[model samples]
Target chain A: MGKNLREPLLKLLIEQKEGYISGEEISQRLICSRTAIWKHINELRSEGYQIEAKPKAGYRLVYRPDRVAPEELIPHLSTTSIGRAVRYQRSVPSTQSLAHEWAKEGAQEGSLYLTEEQTAGRGRMGRIWHSPTHSGIWMSLILRPPIPLNQSPQLTLLTSVAITRALRKQTNLPIQIKWPNDLLIHGKKVCGILTELRGEQDQVHYVVQGIGINVNATESVWPEELRPIATSLAIEGGRTFSRPELIGAICGELETLYDGYLSYGFTPIRILWEEYAGMLGQEVTARTGQGSVKGIAKGLAETGALLLETHTGVQTIFSSDIEW
Target chain B: MGKNLREPLLKLLIEQKEGYISGEEISQRLICSRTAIWKHINELRSEGYQIEAKPKAGYRLVYRPDRVAPEELIPHLSTTSIGRAVRYQRSVPSTQSLAHEWAKEGAQEGSLYLTEEQTAGRGRMGRIWHSPTHSGIWMSLILRPPIPLNQSPQLTLLTSVAITRALRKQTNLPIQIKWPNDLLIHGKKVCGILTELRGEQDQVHYVVQGIGINVNATESVWPEELRPIATSLAIEGGRTFSRPELIGAICGELETLYDGYLSYGFTPIRILWEEYAGMLGQEVTARTGQGSVKGIAKGLAETGALLLETHTGVQTIFSSDIEW
Candidate 1:
C-alpha cells in the first residue's frame, strides 16, 4: 500500500475504536487490495501497534504502543493551535535544536517537534537529559507570543503549571512544580523544561520550550547516578500511562493557559503555579552565577523570577539552581 | 597572480606608505615574479586602492579605499576582542541576518560582519534603514556576555554610548542619542542600533549588536519619507569620513564600554547615556503594545528600562516606540 494510506488507516482505526473494521471495508475505503491491507497491518505491528485479526472480525486495534507519532496523538489532541502541526522523529539529538531552526524559518506559532529518543538530549544549564526510546515524552514547542523580551521567562513557569495540571488529571499522581520549571512526583524529578528565546532588545521574536518527561521508563533507563533522583510515571504511579494521551493533555492545558495569559495577563498562570508549587514557603538555597543565597521560597514575582525572602530583604532570583 | 598573495602584498604596500618599494623588493618579499607583482597591483588598484607606481620608485600606498575589509580596518583597530575576526561581504541583505547565522554556528565573541551595502537593511521596530554602498558603516558584532536575560537591553544602550563617543571623536558632529538607541545628529537620525539576543530563560547565550550608520551618503540616499528625519556624517559634517576608520573606532569604544559594563555594572553606561541623551527631561510619548503613555523622560532604570514619569507615576517602559 502507498505510504499515504498509513495515516488514513490509523485514523480509520481510531475512529472505530469501539469495534473492528473488516479487511474488505478497509481495502475498499483505502482503494487497495486485501493483501496490501495485510502487509500494512504487519508494518504497523512492527512499529509496536497491537492489531488483533480474526477470521470474520477482520481487524481491531488492541493497543497502541508508547509512540508519539502525529497519527497517534492526533485523535487525543483537543487544542486548535498547540499541536496543529507536529514534526515527529524516531530519534534526534535534541528537539530544542530542531525547534530553533524551525522558528528561524518562520514556523507558525504552536508548531511542535516530538522525538521518541534524543541521543544528545539537553537540559537547563547545558546539562544532559537522558531520553530513551519508546519510553518518554521528548518534545519542543515553538511559541510566538506578543510579550516583551524580558517577560519571556514567565512562559517557562506557565508551562510547568500546564504540565503539572495535565499530569495530575491523567495519572492522578500528585505532580508538583519546583520554583521555576522542574516537575516532581513523590519528591523526585520527573520532568524538566528548557526555554530558549530569540528576540530584539524589547520584543521577543520566538521562544522554543523543550519538555522532557519520564513516562514509562524503568529504573535501568537512568544511569546509576540518576537512579536515586529520577523517576517515571510507571515507577511512581504503579501504572503505565499512554504517552500520546499525556502529550495531548499537556498541549490542551497549555493552549488554554496561554490564551488566558494573553488575555488576562500572567496572573492566572501565577496563581496556578503557586497552587501547584511544591517548594513554596520552604527554606531553600539557590546557587546563582554570582553566589549562593539561602532564603524562604515565597513565590514567583510578576515577571516569573523566584521571590525569595532572605535576611537582606525580598530578593528576586532571576536564574539559579534551587535545593531545599 | 595568486589570491593568497593579495593580503601580504597589501601589507607590504601599507608598510611602505611613506615612500615606495621597488618592484624587485615587492616580488622578492611576496615570493612572486615582477610580472605577477604588477598583476596583483593592478587587481588592488581595481578594488579602489590608490597605488602610485613609479619607474624607479616602485609601488606606494597613496590612499586606501573606504572598504571595511579586514586589511583596511586592521591597522586602525586597537581593541583586544572586538573586530578581531572579520567577515566582509561586498553586498548582503543584512549584516544582522548574517550575524545571527554566524552566532548560531558558534561564532566567537568580537566576530564582526561588515558589508559594503545592505540590500534589506533593518532598523528598530522593523523599519528600513538606508545603507548605501561604500558610504555607510553597515556591520554587526557578536557578543556573549554573562548577564541576566533581563539586563540584555543595557547592552543596546551601552552600544549607543560607544557609537556616540566614537562619532564625536571622529567627526566632531555633536552626536546625541535618542532614548533606547537612535543616534541623532542635529536632531536627525544618523545611526541606529539593533540589538538581538538568543538565550535561556535566565542567562543570555549570545547577543548580535547590529549598527547602521549613515556615514558618507548624501541626501539622495534617503527616501522621501525619511528625508526630513535622516542625516549622514557627510551631510552634517560637510566632509566624507573613512568607513573602516569609523568601524575600528566604534569597535574599540564598544569593547571599552562593554568591559566596564561587565565589571562596574550599568552605572557608568547610564551616566554617559544621560549626558548624551537629547530627550532627557523632555515630554515624550511612548507607544507600547498595550497602549501609549506620555511622560517626562526622566532617565533609564537600573535594568535599562526607560523610566518615564507620568501623571500616574514613574513607569518602567521595557519595550516601546518613543516619539517626542
Candidate 2:
C-alpha cells in the first residue's frame, strides 16, 4: 500500500459515517486493493483514530486524535494565510527561538512552530514558563506586518484578544486578559503571550508571537510554588479539552483579527482587548525598571500603550509588570 | 625575522624620525637578522607607508598609509571601545549585512566590519549605496545599547555628528549634515550613513551603523550621472587624504559621543547636531511615502525626530528625505 492511502481511507470513513462501509466499497471508490485499505486503517489507528473493522461491516470512524498534528489540525483550520505552513515538533527548546531562526531564513508570514513539549520555555522579563509534555500549547507564529515599529505592541494585545475569544468559545469559561498579554481565569495565569519584533525605526521586518497555554495540565502537574498563581483548563473545568480543536480556533481567530488590524488599524483590536481586559477601571500597581506607578487602568492608547491615571497625571506605560 | 616583527620595526622607525638608524642597530634592537628587518620594511612599504631605507642610514618613517587597514588604523584609534575589535576586508557584499550576521553570532559591542569595496551595498528605504573599490570608507559598527526601541533613531543622529566632527578636523572644510545622516560638502554629498536595528519594543539586540564616506575618489571615479551631486575629498580638497586617519578620528569621536549620550543623555548630541545641520532654519521639502511637506526646518526634538514648523503646526518628521 502507498503511504498516501491513509488520507483517502480516512476520508472514506468520514464520508460514510452512517453505517460500516465494506472494504470492497472503499477499494472500488479509491481504486486501491483491500490490503491497502487494511494497512491504511491500521496506520490511522496508530495516529489515535478509533476505527471498528468487521468481516462484512468494514471500517467505521469513531473518534479523532487529541494531538495537534497537521493531519488533525489542517482539516479543522479555516484561516486564509495563518497556519498554512505548520511545523510540528515532539520536543523543542523554544518555539520562539526556532521561529526566529525560520523567519531569518525567509520563512513566509503565517508560518507556525508548534511543539508538544518545550525543554527551555521562556516568559517575559527572562522568566521560565512551566510547559510540561503534551499538557499545553507551546507555539509561535511568524508575522510580517506592514506597520510602523511603534504600532507593533498592538499586535500583542490583538493576539491576547484572539486567544481569549478562542478559549471562551471552546471551554465557555470567563477568560480575561491581563494587561499586555496574559490570559487569566479567576486571577490565575492560564496562558502567556510573548511578542518579539525585529526591524528598523520606520518599518518592521517580522514579529514572532509565542503563546503558551496550560490546556490539560492537572493540579499535581504544576510545581508547589506555582500552584497558587497558575491554573490549567483541566484543573479548573474538571475536564480535559482537545488541544487540536483549541489550536484551530485560536489560529482562525488570529487570522481574522490580524487581517482586520492590517486593514483598519488597531482600533478594533483595542476595543476587543478592552472588552476582555481584567484590569480596566481597576486600580493596579505597574512595576517598571525605574519604579512603580499606582493608578487606575483607564484604557489603551492609540499605539496600544497602557493609559494609567496616576496621582500626578495620566501616564502612558509602554512596558511594565502590572499587579492589582 | 618573525612575522610579528612589523610592529617593532614600525615603532623603531617612528621613534627615530629625526635620523635613520643603521640596519645593525634595528636588527640588534629587535632581536632579528638584518635580512628579516629588510623583509619587514618591504612589507610595510607595500602597505602604503613611505619608508626611507639606505645601507648606511637604515630606515625612517616618512608618511603613514592612506588605506584603512587594521595595521594602520588600529594604532591611530584612541577610542576606548568603538574600534577596539576591527575586521578588515578587501571586498564584501555589504558591511551592514556582515555586521548583522556577526551580531547574531554573539559579537560584542563596538565590533567593527570594514571593507574597501562592497559589491551589494544598500542604503535606506532599499536604495543602493555606491561603494567603489579602495577609494572610500565602507564600514559598519555593531552596538548593543540598553535603550527602548523608540530612542534608537537618536543613535543615527549621534553618528552623524561624530562623522561630521571627524571630517571637520581632517579637512577643515565647510561640511554640513543634511537632515537624518547625510554629510555634504559645498552642497554635494561626501558621506552617507544608514542605521539598521534589531530589537523589540523595550530592548535592542544590536544596531549596525553603516557609514560610507567618499574620502579619496577623484572626479572621474564617480559615475557621470552622480558627478553633479556627489563630490569626494580628493576632488574637493585638491589632495588625497589618509582614510585610516579619518576612520580613526571618526571612531574616537563616536566612542566619546556614544558614551556621553548614554551617560548624560541625547541633549549634548542634539546640541552638536543642530550646530552642523544644514537645513535647520531653512525652507525645505520633506518627501515621505505618504506625501511631501514643505516647511522651515526648526530643530530636532528630544527623540531625534526632525521638527518642522509647517503652516498647520509644528510637525515632527520621523523619517523623510529632505530637499531645498
Best by DockQ: 1
Model 1's lDDT to the true fold? 0.90
Question: Per-residue lDDT of A1-324 in model 2, one digit per residue for the tens?
Answer: 497777777787888866789988899988999888888888676544688887777778887657777887888799888999889886789999899999989989899999877889988756798888778899999999977677788888999999999999999888999987799999999999988877766678899989999998877767899999999988888898989889999999999999999888889999999999989999999987658999999999988889999989999888788999
Clashes of each: 0, 1
- Compared with the true structure, all predictions reach lDDT values of 0.90, 0.86
Return the lDDT, model 1, position B200. Answer: 90
Global lDDT of model 2: 0.86
Off by over 4 Å in 1: A1-64, B1-65
TM-score of each candidate? 0.82, 0.79
Please give the DockQ score of every candidate, comma-separated.
Answer: 0.56, 0.36
Best by lDDT: 1
Please identify model 2 stretches exceeding 4 Å from their true place.
Answer: A1-65, B1-65
DockQ of 2: 0.36
> What's candidate 1's DockQ score?
0.56
RMSD of each: 8.4, 9.6
For candidate 2, list the clashing residue pairs, or say none: B1-B36
**Residue B207 deviation, candidate 2, in Å?**
1.6
